[model samples]
Target: MFEKIEMMRMARALGHHASQRQIAVARNIANADTPGFKAEDVASFTDSYRAASEPLRTTDPRHLAAPDWSPADRRTLAETGVSPNGNSVSLEEEMLKGAEVKRSHDLSLGIYSSALDLMRTSIGRRA
Candidate 1:
């Protein structure tokens, strides 16, 4: 029943997006010293949400529907600059991204908690 709620869906999506970003940042940091390693990042949450929310269309009834997107499916980010070693991961930039992910994840959790409180109050339960 709770799964049908739009707020819950959004909260879940936000959480997933943050988690994906964290993983990407970590991977970038881990490969900072590797030669020829390019940094990758997931699409913006807004883009992912818009794509996922689009109505599904199938030209052939026998064809299976497209699967939902997960955070692990990352796209290569355009390089701002590359070191002489051909590595694009910047430790400072990755650290900033990590901090942003942490903030976003916290916000998502806050929203989820608020939604639960609202529901409980609406149902005449103590928040």
Candidate 2:
């Protein structure tokens, strides 16, 4: 029932995306000094949502269907300049990305809270 709500789905997706991004950022920060390590990040939430929400298409009967897309499945190579030692992670950039993830997660939580409040009010419960 509640799972069918588009708003709920979107909020869940946003939370998942934020969590994945935070993990990626943390990994990048941890590997900042590792030689030959490339920075990795997930695609933007909008892009990931669009991709994940897209209907799967089958071009041929013999062709295997594409796996459903999700926030965790959208890893991308970040283009942070490589250092002389071939490490691509940058502390400043990772910190900024972490902040962005925090903000996005907070926004998702706010939306979820508002939805719950609306539901409670509709049911005559104190919101």
Candidate 3:
């Protein structure tokens, strides 16, 4: 349905990414007391959307071309300076990440709503 629209499609993906980050933050917070537990973080979304997009195949003058590169959502260990007990999870960092996840989710919703409004307007309806 809405996935046909590029803006809506991207917004949905962003929302899912935000959810994944939130889970990572929660895991870090839960393991804060565990020994040798490393802080984990999901990759950021600002890494250009087209960074992993496949090269566009164009056969006519109306089409454009791009590059070929793939990016993965790697859960890499965060270096926050390990504590005496070898636990790397920091409550402060997790809290900040929680805030970031909220912002990202909000942005995703905003974009999705805006795209919907555009569609409504095109269909002769009020937003």
Candidate 4:
């Protein structure tokens, strides 16, 4: 199955991360006027994927075990600095983030489609 492919999995993760980041950007834009609201941002997909993809190693049994990892549970953190009204959300920044997320999402979909095409070609099927 294509699920067994590492590149496929990575592409899926990239799409998911883009979705989550888009949600954060939406929330930031929606709460731009709220008092004492801080802008929220998701960690970059590259960093998160790198950390999750790395193999865990334990030199000794005494070492604390690595906990189960899932990108779905990644915590959204507040962006530093705030305006005079104590709200950190910036509409301009959110717009830029939205654009970035869109590009990432598109890239992921392209990767997935290309990989799928390759798979089909390998199986003697036309894509």
Would you estimate the TM-scores of all the predictions? 0.89, 0.88, 0.81, 0.83
- The TM-score ranking, best first, is 1, 2, 4, 3
lDDT of 2 at 76: 94
Q: Is candidate 2 or candidate 3 better by TM-score?
A: 2
Candidate 2 residue-wise lDDT, 11-127, digit = tens: 888998899999999999999989999999999998888977887877888988654447755799998899999999989999999999999999999998998898889999998
Top of the candidates by TM-score: 1
lDDT of 4 at 81: 73
**For model 1, the run of ten residues with the poorest summed lDDT:** 67-76
Clash counts for all predictions:
0, 0, 0, 0
Q: Could you tell which candidate, 1 or 4, scores higher by lDDT? A: 1
Cα lDDT tens digits for candidate 4, 1-127: 7667988988888888898898888988999999988888888787788888787999998998654334666656666679899999878888988999999999999999999999999999999
Ranking by lDDT: 2, 1, 4, 3
Return the top candidate by lDDT: 2
Q: How accurate is candidate 3 locally (lDDT)?
A: 0.80
Prediction 1 TM-score vs. true:
0.89
